[model samples]
Target: MLLIDVVRVSEAVTRTSARLGKVGHLAELLARVAPAEAEIAISYLSGELPQRQVGVGWRTLQDLPQPKLVATATLTDVDALLTRIKAVSGPGSQAARKALVAELFSAVTSQEQSFLMRLLSGELRQGALDGVMIEAIAKASGAPSADVRRALTLRGWLPAVGAAALSGGVEALHAFKLEVGRAVAPMLAGSAPNVAAALEKAGVPAALEWKLDGVRVQAHRSGSEVHIFTRTLDDITPQVPELVEALLALPSTDLVLDGEVIALRPDGRPHTFQVTVSRATSKTDVPRLRAETPLSVFFFDALRVDGTDLLDLPYSERQEILTRTAPPELLTPRLTTDDVNKAEAFFTDVIKSGHEGVVVKSLTSPYAAGRRGAGWIKVKPRHTLDLVVLAVEWGHGRREGKLSNLHLGARDPESGDFVMLGKTFKGLTDELLAWQTERFLELADGPTDGWTVTVRPEQVVEVAFDGVQRSPRYPGGMALRFARVLRYRPDKRPEDADTIETVRALML
Candidate 1:
């Protein structure tokens, strides 16, 4: 199929707000895709590239060659060109890559060129996320949506799963299973105000584990081969030799453990989140970095052990397996209780130890990967909301040339529109400023007014604030007090943002 066909489907998906409409458009495209091109087509339709990275940047995309008047590039043609671009490296590779990108752009129509720019820049926000794509895949392959979702969770790559669904049907999707080395998406947690509320949501006899402010690691050990993946499933085995060594020391020859790795001080208190993340993600001077800021792994749950998959097991059972396979010092501190007072005390102790908060997990609940279910509830001592970014103002002073001040909005459930709440520029690091500036420009919907740039309300950010107060400046009739950004929520969508009603209830 021509690349223009895929671009047309993407445009159709974006023009419609109904979920079924998006699914219909995607399903129709998927059904018409050739078996060999299924993976590339699915990946592109889902706003991803099968090649992952192609060394393209926003600056390179800024100056493109004139697009062709006709559309003739095939799906395979684009994929092959991207492969060639990704292979360019070493000296003079940047110029060579740019030339190749220009060549590819010059061969496609204007619409195809626009699609290529968004696809390469990683800013394609057509709302056809993995959830919607699963339904589309199921509809096209005549398989159950649950099976498609399960296959994606176990496989951890939608392109591969979509290809299997299109080629081999249900049998191929069912072939996916949790493997020792392959990383599955980690289970997520919902949030509550306090320990009592978390416990109430998790039910009695829940396990409250310390919510450490650290990097999430999913370690798999199969004999001497050990692989440690970050939350996004990037293999960091070389960067985290300590974690690999720890996993190799475990008794089980085959195991998949989900946990956190944090840098702790000599006093046993955790370091600041920035310190831990910086140390964990750094790629320089491993031995020196390890000596200066070593990471301590804390296992919270076991998904696979001794050739057995424990994803369907209850939280209590998984905890039991983890306790037997890992040492007490390596396990995250936990307390199982039916009393809210005990849970509150545990939460206090964890907070006092400089941990972030506590995660209250239901004892009888099974692990649900890639989901934020009610089975696990997290409680922190502050007020935080996941709000959408409506617009951003260019920074001044040291932050000049970057997108700094963020205009925050809360989703209005009734109108399905985002209502502006307030603006904040606090809590952004230099790295975050540069990243958001590039991303917001890609999502830009309106022309810049020299001071502010209006963007699509697709980016969700976790904002920490003191409280909410009445304000007539915002259409929501409220504003956040002392609002500061906590972090960007890439895993969440704008639809997952806190509703306007939820923010207003904070006034009570």
Candidate 2:
């Protein structure tokens, strides 16, 4: 199949929100593609070629201007390129890489080579391929939208999901068991200030867990080969050897377990995320890294054990199986007491111990992969902000030729005067950049018609800053720390965003 065909399908699927349209597009591609070429094509269609998990990205337009204008490579060329990369690397080692470089992309100019280099490297930029893929499957099998979602969530890939859509219908899809290797996030929390408050509204028996300040990891062992991946599915085992050793030490072989890899202080409290970062790379020696950070594995959920799928089991039964299968060092602890008062006390203890707040889970809830729902509640510190966008700057580097940065501002709610707060280049997407450029230009009064333009305080965006800090730059003698755009609220006038007084209230 042609690369153009893949692009065509991707464009069509992405444009429609209807799951059926997306599924139909993918099914057509599958039917047209030969099995040999299907893997790469399917990956590309899913927008996962450059694994979103890996943060693989393109050289921005300015860095390689000509390359961005050039047409994307053909599918056959991409397939050939992948084959070359594998051929040079060999099965067991990276010996094949240089050979691939010499044989393939070398012919393209250094500038062009940079562009084609990424394509050959197998990193596609489009994230959330699975959702698009479910759409593709739905389109192909003529199944209902829910059936596609159910099967894909249970089985985790479009090919099998396509088959499920045809063979068993919606029930088959609903009954589909979650399989390993499909990256999914644990159900995120619905928050309340305290457990007693959450209990009054939430119906099920809650499982109180120690919400450790650590990275979430999923460990997969297939025979002797062990892989450790992040919650998002990017492999991180190479960076963390001690954790891998702990995983390999598990008595039950061939398992995929979910847990947190936390840095333990001498006093037994989990360290800040900064200390835990030392253990996240591939080359660190396990014993030494563990001694440096001393990672404690807190196993919470399990998907595979001794070839039996445990995702269908309730949290209670799954916990039993997980605790039994775990090595003593790897067992994650859980508290089942229904007493809401105890939960509040526990939350306070954890916070006092220098940790994030607790995660309250439903004991009876089946793991709801990839969605934040009421089944789990994360009770963390709450923060509020009403900051303004001062000036919009043209995005450079990866975000080239786009509006990716904002000069943040603070408004005097009473006086209606705007003062610059901080600057940020994070969180805006390609679509967002386009929308902002158009909208901000309309709001432009006179100046800022050029590349980096200042805007009126008439538009207010609610921003969440990590913390407030003392700064010499702004008029207020303080700045928004780690500021990120939360959302654009048009509901209220500029005066309605938090007053400078509210910001002062949050400061030390």
Candidate 3:
């Protein structure tokens, strides 16, 4: 398949507003993809690359040669070029990589160049996320959508699932199952206002677990070998030896446990998120970092035990399995109750202990990986909303030349456009400032104003505020008061952002 075909389909998907329309366009494109190009095509249409990283940055993309008048490159050609570029390293490798990038970019037409730029920069906003892509794959391959989604959840790789569905249909998708070594997608939780609301959404006879401020870790143990993965499924087995060793010491030799790794103070309060993430992701001087900020593992759910898959089991059964397999010190502090007052007390105790809040989970719901259903509800004290970054203003003083003040927006479900609510510059560390500057520059839409740089609304950020107030300064007719950034939600897309109606309902 030609690269231009994929670009055109992406454009079509972007122009589409109806979900079925988007799925139809993607399905049509998938039907025409060749078997060899299935993976590349599917990944591109889904706003990702099979190569993952090609060692190219915004600076490298700034000085590209003029695009060709016509498109002639095949999908396979570009994939091979990226593979070669990713392999270039050491002495003069930068120049070699740049030359290859230039060669590849110079061969494409204008539209293809734009698509390639977004695809490389991770800012493709065509709404063809995993959900839409799964529906398309099922439609094209005649496989059930549930089967496709299950395969994606277990495999944690959408392109491979797409290829398998296309080549072998239902039989191939059924082959994907919970394995001891592979990392599956972690189950997510929805948000509620308080304990009562959470219990209402999660139903009675629920298990409330302390929601700690820590990095999510999924540990898979097979005999003596243990592998640890983050929420995004990035393997960091070597960086977190303590976690790996802890999982290996468990009684069950073969099990997949979902948990969190946190750094605690002497009084048992959790350290800042930056401290935990820095220690967990550091690649240099690991021994020293570990000694400085030791991490403690806490298991909450068991996905597999003794080579038996427990993903299909209810939360009640999984909790029993986890309790039996992991020692008490390794389990997250939890409480099971049907009384709302008791649940509220548990939430209050968790908060007083310097934890985030409590996650109320249904006892009978099976593990639904990669889906944020009502099976589990998270209740936090403050008013928090998941908003998208619409634009960013240049910082001044010590933070000069960085993207500092963020213009936050809420999704308008009816029109599918983001409505700007307010701007915030608080709660951003120097590291976050540097990271967002580079990231926002890659998503830059056009020439920036003297102070603000407008970008595509694709980055979802969690914002905590005291309350919402009616205001005329924004399009949403309200603004977040004392708004501050909590963290970036890379696991969520813009489509998952809270709607404007939800924001309006929070008015003081």
Which candidate should be chosen as best, given TM-score against the real structure? 3
* Cand. 2 TM to true fold: 0.61
**What does each candidate score in C-alpha RMSD?**
3.9, 11.8, 3.3
lDDT, candidate 1, 4-51, per-residue tens:
999999999888788889899999999989999999999998888999
**Which residue pairs of candidate 1 clash?**
none
- Give the Cα error of residue 307 in candidate 2, in Å: 3.6
Misplaced by over 4 Å in model 2 are 13-40, 50-78, 85-129, 143-197, 200-202, 221-225, 238-241, 248-250, 285-287, 327-329, 383-508
Ranking of candidates on TM-score, top first: 3, 1, 2
| lDDT at 496, model 1 | 69
Q: In order, what lDDT does every prediction score?
A: 0.89, 0.63, 0.90
Instruction: Return the candidate ranking by lDDT, descending.
Output: 3, 1, 2
Give the clash count for each candidate. Answer: 0, 16, 0
How would you encode candidate 2's per-residue C-alpha lDDT over 426-493 as one tens digit per residue?
66667767877777876664576467877655676756667778788988888888887755654334
- Which parts of model 3 are misplaced by more than 4 Å? 58-70, 90-92, 394-404, 410-419, 426-449, 455-460, 468-481, 487-508
The stretch of ten residues in a row with the least summed lDDT in candidate 2 is 53-62
Which candidate would rank higher by TM-score, 2 or 3?
3
Tens-digit lDDT string for candidate 3 (406-446)? 99999875545789999999999998999999999978888
Of the two candidates 1 and 2, the one with more favorable lDDT, higher being better, is: 1
